[model samples]
Target chain A: MERILFGDNQFFAVNHISDEKSRAQAIKFKDDSAIIKVLDDAMAAGINTFMCTTHDRIANICDVIRDNPKKYKDFKIYPCMPYAHKYANAVTELGIVGTLKQYVPGNFFGSLFKGGVAYINKDFISIMELLVDAEMKMFKGINTPVIFLQNVITDLLLGLGMNELLIAFAKHVESKYNAEAGFITMNLPKLLSVLEEGGIKNPIICASINKVNFRMSGGKELYEEVLKQGRCRVIAMQVLGGGAIPPKEALEYVANLPNVESILFGASSKQNIQNTVETIKYHDNQRVLVE
Target chain B: MLKVALIGAGKMGISHLSILGAHPDVEIVGVCDTSKIVSDVLEKYSGFSCYTDYLKMVDTTKPDAVFVAVPTKFHYKMVKDLLDRNIHVFSEKPFCLNPTESNELFLLAKKKGLVNQVGYHNKFVGTFQEVKKLVKEGFIGEPQHFLGEAYGPVVIKKKSETWRSDPNEGGGCLMDYASHVIDLINDILSPINSCKGAMLKSIYSKQVDDAVYALVGIESGTTGVISVNWSDETYRKMSTSVTIIGSKGKIVSDANELKVYFKSDEHPKGYSKGWNVKYVTDLTEEVNFYLRGEEYSSQIDYFVKAVQGEVPNTVNTFESAWKTDLSISIIKNNSK
Candidate 1:
């Protein structure tokens, strides 16, 4: 039986962390608190698995795990590293020039600079070198399984040309770093087709259902296609469309999707977490309309 | 009580037909188009009779209100003929091939006291409306600079020696597409000082430019950049985004979405992220508001209301003429 995992995807806003200093603080403050609450709430609700992205947030999450290893002894926390190489130059430039204020605040720049210290002053090529360096450092001492979450939006915008660099990066991380690397995408058919074309040997590809209009088409197709792939497990996120979906429907849809190994959701408050648990238990066996 | 006839059974005509078909106060008595196939299809779909000759259709139908969805080149003659028959007109964009012809239509409409409206749907998009509201509310402080871009790959694949491809036939991205954004710029900015742009044939090798880029300077000292291009893919690449940078904050409305960001003193703990983004959903509200009608069942509603003296014609002939003039000037200067 594929286990249903519950966690919030809400960390520091990925786009908001414009600079390294703010990114580091956000890592220490916002992301740290959000992950702790998400994991604590999931454990209380009998959910053993928690999934999140690997941005600056992961550093703080790893710190928390190291500090309170006993509290998370029984829980499995999966941190997916976001593919940041595409805009690494832009992000790093914003950090150094301090013009990050044009887009966001000063703290955001500080966090990004601190979190991205190794690549803060590096050029585009050197940024890539740092990404490989960070990947190596992350794999060296980490005993827990690290699932690097590869996002496609940056790839599409940065002209990485989709699936080519993505597959190569996944293969490198898996083979070179010996980490469990998988492709996560909003486009299921394209991702699966690319994986097949690239001959990706990784066994755990996941997909997320994002956007309100796409909730029906993308969400349903992703649920079924992941099962069909069989080699890869599915991780579903954005269950609420950033709090747009009706609460009851959100829980039921996540619980009922066949072959879904885990569902990641974000909560702004304690009640939001409790309410999700209640909504999931409300319709235990009865099939409900997938929102 | 006014009877209405629709010319051109294309997308806009059918949309108007559906609205007029449902209005309790109006009667969509007839429809006309050059293509018997198109007329027959729309006639069957709308359950109305279709005619080939517009003059004959108008005479036979005796429509008090006529919606002209014909090509821009035909707008001058068709509108002139309709107004000569004392019929009010609701025509689609590119009111005329040039400003002079558009001015003639305006004068003719005025002489006949006929209600006239040109289609500029982007002005009615909810996000733009909200941005206008934010500008009024000083949410983004004093609006200083405005930039807009509207680009799309041309949808009509088979370009014949059609008028749209001919500069004389209102065939350019500026007139066909940029008019919406231009109208929006006029609506938001007061006292237009000067409008200048470069119209280039960047993408296609046709007679007319496939892309146009222009700079509009409002009398308010707010400079704006406008870009219109026809190099978009099969999907609609039309994006009407406006960013007004003010001293206090900024207000932006992309036709795809709308948002206004400003620095707040209160700074609620969580709200520190930035200005919250809100999606606008109601298109009808703005349409009806501009039409000065309680409800807009069809574009015909505005035409009928203007004809019956129920509301002042929101889009007068002068505005249409000005839009045409501005479009022609921008295209002529930019086509380097």
Candidate 2:
């Protein structure tokens, strides 16, 4: 896991605080060139990992990156699955049957439709695999070291107390994609316990770990308890607590944590990327010196 | 444990079921849905008794409480039936298609002395809750005006005939998006008394208003703006925010964060006079089980506690949700 991972929220217009900023992002990232430019900027700033959702527009971004394989050689993309909003938006625009037709891995639909229907209609595991395969189609040939189940599905499955599905997701991602499955969740303590109980040792989990405990379900104390146990590889995201904490403070808090091997941040400019990378490097160096 | 049965297996239904299944006070005995495949999957995996007929499931399970997550049109009949059976009910919001019927349900729930609630989850959001707290504590003293706005990408293109696009089914920006903002405003500041210059614009949908804009009179003797649009593609998801400007200072809050400005250096409520920014994490207490957000689980937990007599059947009761429905009705009538 890279110490700093870039996120695709800025490109996809996902500002949590300001609608104005999100609208501006929607306008700014209208071109694939602009997105490519930012990726290049992150790479230039010595950050190589891009953690992103499998939104349809991301395919275009992947196409540009694939075209310039030489430039993006060391760059890694962590693709998150089941881009929930695309299906939701599609249902609104194309209706259910049409949306299914649009997304059901079109060419292989003929071959896999029977197994898929049985899985969804009668049982469940194969249906998840189909969705993953459909979502992972866009990132073909890219060095996707980790595939993430987005928090929306992850937390729901966690709450359902269905640990087998979580285990299945990890196993499926490993078996099919040759990538480690990273579960992005709001509840880190509970998810880590469930994964471990399900016999998934040292699973890769990304969650909100911040100074102010933003989005860290079960709160700061429970997160600290789990992280100290060192049972799982934790990727600390929303380190700024959804832009609440200052960068220095947020990075310092995360850099000093036990199991946080990575820090994920989304920024639009070259300077911001450089600043985040430099600040993280500084805090990490400071922590190493103290330890 | 309190025996509970779910009446719908839609998206919201499944969410509530998961939370309830994990709830310490809850024992989910029956899972009812109209879909065969959904019921089959749930029955196989979750091991809950699944049924196609909700009435049969209710009769067999004998649940102390029922969570109704069906669409708006069926909400009235199903919730009414459940209430008549002397069962506690928690229905998903836009409580009823008609405000008068909603009021009647409120009265019935009160008369029956049943613990009832509506799924207005924003009230459970910590940032919004912080806003309500600050308003009540006079941190922003005597709020003079407010701007309640909600935007989302629901109907960006003209395509389908889902319940969301049907006016009769309580679908549109007014019912789907604006109702949330109106409910938050009704609780956070003051209940909306009247609506003026309401404009329901159909940017995409033919039968439903895709955007709603109006000046609403609050019970606090001030007018505020209610601006909501479901056709905005810029927002990644539904975003609701409220801005309250008062005599002492101001407050602007969304689901994620809260920012307040104070005019005096008094440091009321341990907040600085100039400006204080508080994230949802600061306001939200830890929940036993967490899902998409703390609010979703917390709202259900509050209802469960209320049902168990550990807490009062206050926040987001049938009365408040009916008020939100009335506000929606007011906006719709004036938009005409």
Candidate 3:
């Protein structure tokens, strides 16, 4: 994982601070070239990894990256599964059976027969694997080092006490794609314990970690306690607490934390991206000197 | 731990079950759903008492509170039954189908002195909470006009019929999507007392309206417009936003952030005369068990606290939901 990974929330109009800004972004990035331009900006700031959801628009972005193989030789994408809306739109257009046929890949009847078997035998793991294959279609032939389960499904599974599914996802991703399976959740502490119980050691987890505990379930103390124990490798996100915390203070807090191998952030402008990278580096340097 | 039971195991019901399962102060006494498959799986995996019959679940569990997440047609009868049993209840939004039924339930809950809530979770969003506070404090002095909108790709093309495709059972965009906006406008500004005109357009659905455009009048002597569309493919999910303009300045907010501009030097603390922006993460309060968003868990937490009498029933109460239901009815009538 890169120390600093560029995110895709801004391109998808997922601003956490301002609806006006989100609308503005929806207009600004209406074209795929605009998204590529921002990627270029992040690269210019010496950032190469793009951590993003599997939105349909990302397929087009992937096409651009695949076309310019020379320019993006070191560029990588960490694709998160079940971009939710894609499947939702599919389910709306086609019924449940139609949805499976649409995304299951391979011969339509063959996949249907497999899904039927999975459903009859109550073998959800097989269905989950097939879905991962479906979501991976867009990222074919790309440098995807890690595939993630979005928090929507991750936390739901956590609440349902479905640790087996998480473990299955980890094993399948590693075996099939030769990539580490990452989990994103709001409740980091609980997820960590569950993953550990299932024998998935030092899982790569991304969660909201900041000075104020914004979106951090189980609170800041529990997060600090887990990080102290070094139970897992964490990718700290929402470090600015959705723009609530000041940049310097937020990054300093995360940068000094233990086992936080990476910081994920999203910014539309090059100046904002550069300033963030600089602040993170400054705080990291200060931590090293203090040590 | 408070004794709690869940009735209905649909998508929303499962989410509620998940959050409640992890709640420290909640004990899952029973779960009721008509589907044997749902109840059996939940019973096996979660180790909770599950029943295919609602009446049997209630009689056996005798829960202190019950979360009613069944379809719309079942809400009034089931919620009324739970309230009659003196059990606190939380029903999913679009409170009840008609104003009369919702009004009766609201009054009954109020008269019986039983705790009641509806699941309009947007109220728990931090930016919207900030928007509520600013509006209450007259951040935009002397409210003049406002606009509420929600758009997504729900019914972009024709598909098989479900509860959502029926106006009576689904309530279409006017209930499923617009009710959130109506509830927000009523909660943030003032109760929507009247609606002048409404247009229920069926861009895709055969029986129900896909888009709702309405002119509404509120109790604060202000009128506003509501525009909601479920067929808009530009958005990935349902996105709601509100803009309010007043004599002093203006305010615009969404689930993500709140933006305000004041004309004079009378700015709120940490805000300036010019445009000021606040993010949801800045204002969100932490919860014990989080699923999708902080708001989802926050809403349930508030309900649990309310059940314990630790907090008053002020937000998302049965009364507030009734007002929204009445607004939906008014829109339907005016559109006709």
Candidate 4:
């Protein structure tokens, strides 16, 4: 996780508060060119890591990056898994078998006939591997140093007591993609313990760590306690509480946290992006000076 | 009696509230919604405790079952939390927004020995059930091909959006409308084996598709096509139809009627099968308070029965919905 990592929520029109804002964003970033312009602005502001969902549009972004490798050489994507809506839409149109065939790489028929059967036979680990591979397909030859399990899957698995799969994910991402496995969850304290119990040490976890406990499941105090005592690298997201918390207070609150090594935020405009990055940098520098 | 609580105040949630509030076997414990106005109205009408937070509702009411009528994106987390608390869940469909989460929930429900149902109400629709029975009886004699179509007047213009129009939340017409058709296909025909030639178009919203078309092949060697348009205002009301063709006969079913056409008089005893039409009302049992449709109440009744251990949790179980989720996943990924 990199400090001041750029997020794709703005590109994808994910507004937590207002549908009007989301619709506006959808219209503004309807084209990949518009999305690229914002990414370019973020890069120009010296932010390199791009944390994004594995949305279909991201494939276009990856293509542009891959085509002009020199220009975006330092750019990186933290690929998030199970972009739930994408898979949901795919399943509706393709059927599960058809969806798996389309997503699982290599021979479509072979994977459909063989791997699909295995996945149904409860070889879920293999299915997980196939999905990871499918999600990472668009980021081929790009710098995706951290592949994430989206909160939709992460918190579900957390709630299901299926933390072992998280360990398997960590191992698979490390061994296969040679990237760190980042788990984004609403409940960071519980996830950290589960990951630790599953034998993953110092796991990279992205969570909502805000002053108002906006989306933080266990609340701010518990998260701060875990951050102080836990052996995980925390990437604080939703730090602005989806705009519930002011940027200055939110940045200062998270920047002073013990194990928060990164801050992830999304903004459509160049000025908002610059302000956030600068705010985080200023707070981080101030914390260093105080220490 | 099963103590049931509802977790959403959307259209589907209100429907559930109506049924649960009136059903004899159910004791409405609590209902949670983000909208205070919706909660207040439901609370006033139903005399049930209302909360804006689901966790609070669950902890306080301690219902044995929860009806999750929340948005598609919230399905995974909300259902998982209830399932973790060992509470049975009746979730609105698109079981989850994706297969991975659906699979996880399916397995978790099984592991917890809790009854789980997805809101594929068409499975309980009388004509559709009759269609399933006819297919099972081989009235169509070797099912070969099928078609499912849904056209509606909604999403016809540039309107204010909601989660339903967001691809990250609601998967446009593909997830919201076509999903029901796909689930109906799974119920009436063999599970869809593969899908191709998908066209997802956004006429109203840039993020969510308003029209979707796909070709699907079933496990029983039946080829199928699904076409849905939420923006089609040509119809006075929402219209859905399913047509199944086989070697001996063909069945055409719409919202109102089920028509069977057989090559000869070799059909079930009720029909000479040259062509026969049966209104859906004739096939459906008369219900006392059927708002929305009989399928809505019927599905809820089925779920309550399943939860009461009186029947097998057969209709739209997580295992079955996972297949539907996978099919949707295929269509969406292919359309890309």
For this target, which candidate reaches the highest lDDT against the unseen true structure?
3
**Residue B41, candidate 2: C-alpha displacement in angstroms:** 2.0
Question: Model 3: how far is B228 from its true place, Å?
Answer: 1.9
Error of 4 at A63 (Å): 61
Give lDDT per model, in order: 0.58, 0.85, 0.86, 0.80
When only chain A is evaluated, what TM-score does every model earn? 0.64, 0.92, 0.92, 0.92
Which ranges of candidate 2 are over 4 A from the true structure? A90-102, A107-120, A286-291, B139-141, B263-267, B272-276
**Tens-digit lDDT track of model 3 for A37-74:** 99999999999999999888999999999999999999
In the order shown, the candidates' Cα RMSDs to the true structure are: 18.1, 2.9, 3.0, 20.5
TM-score of each: 0.53, 0.92, 0.91, 0.54
Better of 2 and 4 by lDDT: 2
Model 4 TM-score on a 0 to 1 scale: 0.54
Please state the error at residue A50 of candidate 4 in Å: 65
Runs in model 3 lying further than 4 Å from the true structure: A67-71, A88-121, B35-41, B263-268, B272-274
Docking class of 4: incorrect
Q: What is the DockQ of each candidate?
A: 0.02, 0.45, 0.45, 0.01
Steric collisions counted per model: 28, 0, 1, 17
Could you arrange the candidates by DockQ from highest to lowest? 3, 2, 1, 4
Q: What fraction of the native interface does candidate 3 get right in terms of contacts?
A: 0.56
Candidate 1 per-residue lDDT, tens place, A83-184, comes to 343233233223213323333323543565567544333232233334555544432334435455554332231111234445546656656656666555
Model 3, C-alpha of B256: deviation from truth (Å): 2.6
Report the lDDT tens digits of candidate 4 across residue range B1-336.
889999986656766776665466888888888765445444443356889889999999899999998889999999999999999999998888889999999999999999999998888767778888888998889888899999876676786556777788866888888888988898788777687678999897767899998998887777889999988855434567899998899998875567889898778978885888765545665333333456776788889999899899988999999989888898888888
